[model samples]
Target: MMPSIKFLRIIVVLSASLLFGCSDKSVDQAEFPPDKTAAVEVNGSDYSIEKGGYRWVRKKGLETETVTTDHASPNQMAEHLQPISVKSGQKVKVKIEDNPILNVFLWNQSGKEKEIKLEDDQITVPADKGTYIYEVLAEWKNGEISYTFVAEVQ
Candidate 1:
């Protein structure tokens, strides 16, 4: 009877430890593809940005897998989205859920692309009045994602 009771106690302890350990591991290894949220702020309004191409590395235990996807260009992705209105030369804020390195660019209708310098997570809208498409490339330690949004400067 004494031996049986000891054995039962050991089993219970091991079971609890295993369950807690597994849960910790799952939390450490984030979801296969992280859920990333991105947006643009214009005139105190937040506009969700469309996600574009991406190359990400997913890790599980000691193994890692690279996932790559190619999507339409920034202009193409913006075509379907209603342009967010902004004042010419106004500052537009880029809001992403995580702190990833960001590279921003603006595209004109004629297919010209120009990199925009970001200051305090904000970019100045094009001075000229017209519609413009923006591409934001965000890179984390484990992955990279491209986002797009269209803005019409009045």
Candidate 2:
């Protein structure tokens, strides 16, 4: 397929920025090859490295699918807690509400649990093919409330 004109414009802009030193910030020359690729920092808790014109390490916990929800209390927002059916290499995003102090966890079938740090009030689904238990904890001034959302991947 032919490269889009917009993509070509981006390449030109990035190339010019690199050659002209448009910004005061200095990037490691050895790491970022000026010929075809460049290293850029993405602002977030997600850890990543840009190389070969692609990100080597993805920020998701699993290598495949990712899941996120908009509801801080999935139970209260029962509509958002519905089971999602996603194919391989797809992302599941649910729209709901949000909370200031919220803690989320994902429990896999293997009995291993992972703490999910919400980005834009969402979390990524695991790469496994089974039932996943999503636990959401919200803290208020008086006490804390918990919610759960389940997702099944095929």
Candidate 3:
């Protein structure tokens, strides 16, 4: 068997080499893009923060539980709703029966989803030329209802 001092020295040298050798591989920050990045946009005197890649701007005072509604169900709420067609850069109005409190989310053809805030029962259509599908969720004391509609932009 080796002497105690020699054994200690061998252990120290091996530990030092392993620790120092592993740290030499430092990652380059430039090679990896940030998972979230913010862009500042200035229009006139107002500035807005635009986020890239799955980040969305939050709209206050609108929240609802998302529940899937079957289109075949006799209680289908969408059957009572109407589809909308709009020109590019035009705004579309969406009115719900009884105007129940609900949350509206729009999923674009590009697969990007956004929650829209209704002002006077209207939502502005996307400026990009594409058809967008919208989902509206409403919950009441008794039960819940989900309505869907399509907005076409030519």
For all candidates in order, the CA lDDT equals: 0.88, 0.46, 0.48
Candidate 1 weakest ten by summed lDDT: 24-33
User: Model 3 — TM-score against the truth?
Assistant: 0.42
Candidate 1 clash pair list: none
Write one digit per residue (lDDT tens) for candidate 2, span 1-154: 9999999999999999787885644443433211121111122322211111111121223333222324233323333445545444344332323333666777544432778766665566667776566665554332343455565666
Task: Kindly report which residue stretches of model 1 are placed more than 4 angstroms away from their true locations once superposed.
Answer: 1-8, 15-29, 110-112
Each model's Cα RMSD: 3.1, 20.1, 17.7
Q: Write candidate 3's Cα lDDT for 9-55 as tens digits.
A: 99999999999877845433332222222111112221212111121
Decide which is better by TM-score, 2 or 3: 3
Clash pairs (backbone) in predicted model 3: none
Q: Which ten residues in a row have the lowest lDDT in candidate 3?
A: 46-55
The positional error of residue 20 in candidate 1, measured at the CA in angstroms, is 9.3
Candidate 1 lDDT over residue span 1-154, tens digit each: 2679889999999999898977744666466578698999888889999999998897667888999998988887877988899998999999997889999988766663889999999999878999889999999998999999988889
Q: List where candidate 2 sits over 4 angstroms from the true fold.
A: 1-82, 87-98, 108-112
